[model samples]
Target chain A: MRDEFRADLHIVSQLLVDMAEAVRAAMRQATRALLTADRKAAETVIAQDAEVDSIYRQVEERVCDLLARQAPVASDLRAVITALHVAADLERMGDLADHVAKTALRRHPSPAVPAELRKVFTEMAGVADRMAEKIGTVLSKPDADRAAELDRDDDAMDDLHRSLFAVLLSDDWPYGVETAIDATLLGRFYERFADHAVNAGQRVVYLITGEPTA
Target chain B: MRDEFRADLHIVSQLLVDMAEAVRAAMRQATRALLTADRKAAETVIAQDAEVDSIYRQVEERVCDLLARQAPVASDLRAVITALHVAADLERMGDLADHVAKTALRRHPSPAVPAELRKVFTEMAGVADRMAEKIGTVLSKPDADRAAELDRDDDAMDDLHRSLFAVLLSDDWPYGVETAIDATLLGRFYERFADHAVNAGQRVVYLITGEPTA
Candidate 1:
């Protein structure tokens, strides 16, 4: 392997890991904003998304340069292409966190989740954070076994999403329609954040094995 | 243009046009299913997404072939890359319609939207269908001017999405929690459907002008 090309690959992979960590931090802050009505935290998450976007665009340009310069074929080419897709997923995970933060900012000083829904969203946030952490791990190591675990990890988020529905469906539900809408949107943000992480993991596994991935 | 490469590009663009049309029809059918409680229509919409997925994969492969064989740079390379992005948006648009259909199928005989909210979903579906139609037209012509029109079109869908909130927030709201959850999900599907169309339009503009669209 040429030392320079190896360096390029290393930087690309490392940037993705950095982006995944950024996504996790944003989600953690966004969750705090949503749970505690911390407007500052929400604004911070939203502001930080621009940095993620810039890094995403930079990674995109680097991939294009490598493709044009190296003209890589087969598995090497797959690595570059898969990196593009995973970069996109990481960018979107950041956007999902931004969405959560915006919800918190919009509701400012008032909890997006009513008292009843707080515990479930908190759990959802925890699951999403864990998934984000795993994306970084899988990116650094490209472990097919560890990458496969994200799907099962996401099932817990889905189950939490369903529980949110169950509560909304229950006759004893006391919240008004505003609360219902906030809860629904907040739940979806967490669910999709995990899905993007799962997507990134799948890309890692595909890059390692040259298998098809969603 | 070389005769063979021209033929390949033609096929790729045509398939996207076809996929865009399929997206429109799927959303139309899903809206019918949701509004009329037609399980058959919902199933048809769900099943048709597979076709969209196949076409998307084919487009991707063709783009890779073109890039490798043509080694297109500058505007030509942008066209190939932008096609990949547009194909993704089309695939996701199909998935969004499928989500709407699944919601209908899940509710079975009961309409997903309560009687009062039916009018709004109908309007949202109409906006989505119109946007999908525009995507087909833009793909065929590559008209940068026409591509910019999608931005304003998406705003209408966003407005319709907000209206769902108005009804939900109303003190006179008569629906149960199930209805609230269903309405929220339905609104999101249509909103995202339009957003994907807008994304495709942005790609079209970028391909034509080599300018950033989003």
Candidate 2:
């Protein structure tokens, strides 16, 4: 029975890692769509969001089944509960990526990101991408130290997010209110994607240390 | 043991209601601060957010305890899991209110919302407030029919959010990009607050019906 419980827990962990990967790929494609105005890439990200949601639902069902059948306690119980939280954060990350794709599609042929601001967004996307990747690594290994690194990556994303605002608010910004609004929402989408990634990392830390990260 | 589980579940439900009330009050204060540029009101909302977070932590701990001790199955297990999800949504609702308050503080004595756009924000706040209140109602009663009403309220919020962009994009708009960015983000904060409320309502429906709401 103990062996079976451990196996179930492992399955849950692997499912979370799969979710992280899907979210990472989605964000990468979404960023491509934004940078190049690739309609096909945007459409792919928007459509594949359902696949991420499907994985999230699977995680929930598996966790519920484990709890009902095994009645996992102590660290095991924490692991099961944390899986639910991690899956939720990853699901939201996928949605953020979809939001980015939709934003790109909203402008269609015209780039959602202005050329002047594209560098900052590229940096933001890179940071978010790294954070999502780290989320997968941390989930697979359950390393508290590795999970702590996502917080630093989140800081980098924040710096990029602020830089995005600086450009938007600059005296020379020629993009009218519509473009400014689009950029504002786009920046928020990337920033929140990082936030949710950090959240998932924290849940992993909590699972390992039995102590919630502040 | 069943009786004990029932008692504990009741406590969790009541805590969710308290959280709903706290979030509703925080949003109300936040909107007041945004419209009036009242620093004190903004400060109050920011400070009281800790109280909401504390309640959220309490809910997490209680749900953990319940799961470990009772190992509830079937409908009982669904109720416990839904409590955790609902608590999370309510906690996020608190964060959204904090975001609104901080936006108001960023602009200080000048209103974060322009005088012309105040009516739309007021309408948005009203829809959000009503949705939060309805979350408490649905959670307490576990009525799927009542929970479904939050979806309609969310549609109203979406309309107000769109109308806000129309105002910002108007040719006669005198406020520049900085104000536009602030309004855009503030609009998103209120819109997401309603979204979370709708999410909470859906969880309640899931709990009662044993089917996830689409």
Candidate 3:
């Protein structure tokens, strides 16, 4: 590769790493906002989504520029395209954070989620955070086994989701139908957030092994 | 492109189109199963889902092979990657259809939805089907204007969704909470299915104009 092209590739790689970190930060802030019902924290998450979105756009433009200029081949092209998809998943994760925050604002003054449900959500968030953290590692080290472990963690999130729904279905819950709906939607957002993280991890597997994993 | 590469690309493209059509057919069958309370039809939809899943995996494998073999650049690369993403969306849509059909099966013998509710669902299905058809065109033609119109149609689906929920929530409703929950989940599946179709259309716009919408 030419020196200038090599230099641009390094910059692109750095940008991708930084974008993943930004996505992780957004997920953390959003989870905090949901768990604590902190309006200011939620606002911070909401505000940072624009930054994530901007970074996503920037990454995409840079990728397109690289494709046009250097005409990346094989693994290089996979890296660029995978970065595009991971950036999107991260951006949507931010949107889900925004969703959780919006839900918090609406259900404020009244704690819509019971303490037990909150416990389950906290666990789910942890699993999601771990998965998002691994997307970066998976990208830089495409052959790593850590990506596979992230897939395993997604199972825990699914379990939590099932438990949440089971609680909602229980007769002991005297909460109104609206509250149940809110809880169900909230659980779904978290479940989907983790699922996207799993997707990012799976992309890493595909980037390396060239095969889709469950 | 070499003659062999071009031939393979042609085959892959045709398969992608076929997979989308098959998904649409599965959805139609599932919707019919729901409207008519046909357990037999519901089972058929469920059985066909395996075929849809297999086709999606085949599409994924072909796209990955193309990415590795031809190393397509720029627009060609975008088209291949978009095909993979669109295939995933289509497969997920089929699963949602199966979900709807399963709900129908559960409520069979004593029709979960009344004639009025069935009419609403039939109309909603018509709108959803159009959105799916538009998505197929958007993928093949990469037309920005047509893609934008699909977004407007999505709004109509949202309105229908709200109306469905409103009817479910009314005091005049005679069904139990289980029935209400089933309706809510069914409506959600269709709503989300249309949303993904819209996402596919948006990607087509991006592919054509190299600009992001929403």
Candidate 4:
């Protein structure tokens, strides 16, 4: 029974890594769809979110079962419980990507971003992709030091999000209210996506160190 | 030992209820500050969030300690674990309220809502307060049926959020980009505040029914 429980725990960790990879693909496609106005790509990203949700449920069920059957104590208990929250964070990150996809679908054939802000958003998307990659690495390895870097890397995304506001609030701002709202909402989605990645990474740090990130 | 665990569990519940109430008060002050552009009110809301965080940590520590010592199983286990997640949801709700207060602080002396949208936001704030109230009641009692009502009540807030989009997207939108962005983000913060409430309440339902809320 004990060995079986430990094996289940290992399976849960692997499932999260797989889930993270799937979300990364969705994030890439969703950003592409948003930048290029590809409805098909957007639709694909939206549909793929179902897979992430499925994995999330599986992880949740496994955690609950482990808690009930094995009754893991101390660090083992923390690891299982932390896995649940990390899965939730991953699922939410997938939803954020879905939000980006829906934005693309809403403005289909007309890129959701203004031409002037295109470069900035492209950078934001790049940062998001890098962060997702880092998340996958941490999930697979559970390295606290590497996980710690996700936040430092995320500062770029946050700065870009604020820069988006500077553009919108500037005296020379020329975009209509619609474009401004689109940019604001999109910027928020990407920034939050990175934040969730940072959050997930921080959870891994907690799991490894047996200490709260704060 | 089991009886002591039950007593500790009861205390956790009470702490969560009191935490919910404090968060509700913060929500009230933050919304008032946002609509009125009252700097002092916003500042107070901002400052009070620390107490909510402090209470959150206390709840978490108690729950973790209970898990470690009691080794609760089945429904007993579910209650304590659900309490952990619910407390987290509550903490996030408080942070959302703090976000609202900060937005108010950022736009000090200039009302966050446009003149025409004032009535709608007033209604949104009322809906949020009502949801928070229901959450408090349910936290104290832990009734699945009562907790189920939270999602239905949340529909009003969702509708209001949609109404915000309608205003922003309307061809007649007269506000500048900055105001449109502000209203869009503010609308989202309130909508999510209600969402966290529903999430917390749903966890209560799970606790009662011993069933996943999916």
Query: What interface RMSD does every candidate have?
Result: 1.6, 0.6, 3.2, 1.5
lDDT of 1 at A100: 96
TM-score of each: 0.96, 0.99, 0.84, 0.95
The candidate, 3 or 4, that scores higher on TM-score is 4
Q: How well docked is model 3, in DockQ terms?
A: 0.29
User: Comparing 1 and 3 by TM-score, which wins?
Assistant: 1
Off by over 4 Å in 4: none
- Give the whole-model CA lDDT for all candidates, comma-separated: 0.86, 0.93, 0.75, 0.88
Residues A45-104, model 2: lDDT tens digits: 999999999999999999999999999888889889989999999999999999999999
Checking candidate 4 for backbone clashes, the offending pairs are none
**Candidate 1 residues A37-133, lDDT tens each?**
9999999999999999988888888877776666666677678777888998999999999999999989887777788888899899999999999
Under CAPRI classification, how is model 2 graded? high
RMSD (Å) of each candidate, 1 decimal? 1.6, 0.8, 3.5, 1.7
Over 4 Å off in model 1, which ranges? A1-3, B1-4
- Model 2 interface Cα RMSD in Å: 0.6
Highest DockQ: give the candidate number: 2
Candidate number with the higher TM-score (1 or 2) = 2
Query: Tens digits of per-residue lDDT for model 4 on A1-214?
Result: 8798779899999999988898889999998998889999999999989999999989977887788788788888888878888898889899999999999999888888878888889999999988889889988887889999898879999899889899889998886888888888899899989988998998899999988887
**Candidate with better DockQ, 2 vs 4:** 2
On lDDT, who's better, 1 or 3? 1
Note the DockQ of each predicted structure: 0.58, 0.88, 0.29, 0.66
